[model samples]
Target: MTWTCTECEFAANEDGQDACVACGSERPEEEQETAAEAAENGDDSAPEVVVIELPAKEKLGVKLMPPKDGVIDHGLAIDNINNPLLENKVQAGDLIVAIGGQNVDGMGFSGAIDLIRKMPRPLAISFEIDEVRRQEVVREKFQQNKDNDLDTQLTTYAVVFDNGPMGLNLEEAVRYGIDGAVVRALKGQAKTSGMISIGDIVYKVNETDVLCMPYLEVMNVLRNATAPKTLQFVPKEKLADVQRVNSRHSESFRLRESTSHVKQKLMNNPRLVKDDGNEGDDTQSIAQLIMDNKASPNVTAEYLLELRVDDRRMVMACTSESDKK
Candidate 1:
């Protein structure tokens, strides 16, 4: 009879041969077939292997310096320690060893002082000094272990200019009953200049009063207000010329001049008088008027003031005494 070993595919005559010539297996054909089937089905395969890779170890030279017994002054600047580290030719990965009480003599290393104060010790300390390199290492370690699809929430707010006009048109400005002013007093005129160059207040809009509102809020109201608005505000002192120029071209020129002059006269009066149940006749002091009326306190007042001073300085520096007008 012919016999074939299924395990090794070895064939031989079964005439007195109990084992296959190639495999040396004495198993019967049926057993050999079963073993071969188990191998094919992976039932007899080797177990899966797992490998973990650790970060490469680099030797950092660390020496424990004896703690200084005396208290260090706490006021010692970080520059003192940082400068020393730089001077000693300490590389990024070098370790700094510090010893002393909670405070370094009173002034130990800033980093060490912080750590010791937070932790209870006989503090024996060992740490790498590679600030930049250590941070990179830590970041890389966490990044590798992080999951791919993580959800994160982010919130943002608009950057608002504190004192600038936030882009308002005439219609919107009028609809919100927005009021603003320009003042001549802010311009430092000796008399009514009539040129309303800067510093004016808008005391009211469409006869509605506004004295306590912030400048930006007033602008926002105007920019968002409905069309065809009337803005009424007080002019600063020494700005009669500017007021005339502004009023001349204005649609309500006649009414504005008459009302403004009346308001001015009323303001000049020492005794306050109520007109038509309105307190103080809708008039404001020159300083209050300028603060309330200017487009931007930062730009119109602050920036202009600084620029004027700088210009005067530059002129004084360049001009001879006769040239100064």
Candidate 2:
């Protein structure tokens, strides 16, 4: 029989073992009995393997570390905001010891993987985490990042990227108090400066908490924030362990039934073809186009362009669908 330390999850031989060699913690009484029963059962299962795919578009959201010392530490090192493992109540740094009632505590990396692949679903995992260690990490983060004026003052100068100026593309989500506009797109400078990232929910601009704020008022705040302005943002990914999109979409080649059909669609879209609206073409050539063409700052047109760029992907999706059809 094997014994394990509840604190560090270190395993030991024999039912009488009292302390863990790794952390010197007292072993739980029930652990030894469980191992003894497992030793008798002698690990037998059918060879055929059944693979269960997780929910679509939702990432498992785990970064696996390679085994060291021939032992698989099936531990969650870092947690992605929408990680399914976390939504399953698995915490960062938790060591997985069993899957589907099968003990895999002593297994090597490959052995553990094999066990997981062979186990039937819905998967029931048993794991342990060093609560003391986890707490220390959290406390350290709070002290370093949040000890100062994180709430009252924001830190970032949204610089201009080669692509454009710094500011998130936004959409209106009235339920979230984002009646004016919601940040949906972020330029390179904002992300590089650590001011914002993709999928951030903007709450306040310069600490005004712009709920029910007029659209013009919101724009005024942003325009007024010349340099070194801070906008409060919340990362949307952390809200759920696994984020399931309400609808999943993609330009699948299979959907066209043949490569030729895929080619036909691309050929059909004028924008997709070279020389159709090629940037290399001069302004004069663009002006001569059959379609309505205009150049240089039309204030009204520029504002509309800004709105489109704010949700560039949405615009692209619409354009793509329109072109394909």
Candidate 3:
């Protein structure tokens, strides 16, 4: 039997233990009574926290916003394309309850960051996985795609690819948002087969639905599956409808609530503009001049295409001399 510490919220401590192992905080009196009552009533649905160990050497590759006013809240890390948190099966809005067994209940934004920075290698971080966030994200994506014409429904198709040179570019088959494995380009035998085409999203491999699986896990499933593999795919445009139907079938996948003010506040962050240094500033500044019969400026569309020799050379150099091709 185990009980959660109220001070640190560490739930892994044994019942006999007088204090929390993580933060060394004593168990709360209310928690002790609740645990006793739960045991007496045979309550088996007690909460269990999930924790993950991450090495300090690797960057988390995530953008985190500090909780305002030292309020400990969930969903500090924002999810975006290629975010490591998403790769680890964590949704956009998950809690960072503790770092290295220390609870971050009142830790200010800077304090949390400092703790994470100073923590030892392979730090244990407890996360309270929130499925509501996942549902909201998927539902938002589904709503965006609702504008697609549903009158002409596109159905999924299957193609069997033999062993050797399957012709699918496995590298580009990585997960992109909720679109699953998008078919970027098809060549060789895959192109020869009229059944599959570019822009088709992989729905399943060997009749197993991998739409929600991690990209690497999906890849492993493909690599380990038996040959003469039947690949199921749907037109890229119809993925949303399929997801909607799936959500309808399973309540867990369905959207439970709309986006909240807290989530919106967290999402509203300043964007960073990248600066490509002015290497050819002088040459690009020299624009070709054109004048009408009156000698006034005549900036026509054709005239805008024209540039001085040096400017043209600079532009070509900027494009790695690809303009000649």
TM-score of each: 0.16, 0.25, 0.33
Write model 3 residue lDDT over 96-204, tens digit each, in one string.
6677777677667788787778777787666555566657877876765663444125487888989888788643232222424667678877889887767677778
Query: What alpha-carbon RMSD in Å does predicted model 3 have with respect to the real structure?
Result: 20.2
Cα lDDT tens digits, model 1, 1-325, are 2345666764332323466444567758675565567656866232211111112231222222333443343222121123332434433333332322111333445455455445443333222234454356457546644421110111111111223332222211111122233332331221232333234445444434433354455656555544445544443442343333332233421234457767666567656532333467366554334434545322211111112454232111212333222
The TM-score measured for candidate 3 stands at: 0.33
Ranking by lDDT: 3, 2, 1
lDDT at 139, model 2: 76
User: Which 10-residue window of candidate 2 scores lowest in summed lDDT?
Assistant: 241-250
- The parts of candidate 3 lying over 4 Å away from their true place are 6-48, 68-70, 74-88, 141-325
What clash pairs does model 2 have? Answer: 76-93, 82-241, 169-184, 169-185, 170-182, 170-183, 171-182
RMSD of each: 29.8, 19.6, 20.2
Highest-TM-score candidate: 3
- What local lDDT does model 1 show for residue 47? 20
Error of 2 at 32 (Å): 14
Report lDDT per candidate: 0.36, 0.46, 0.59
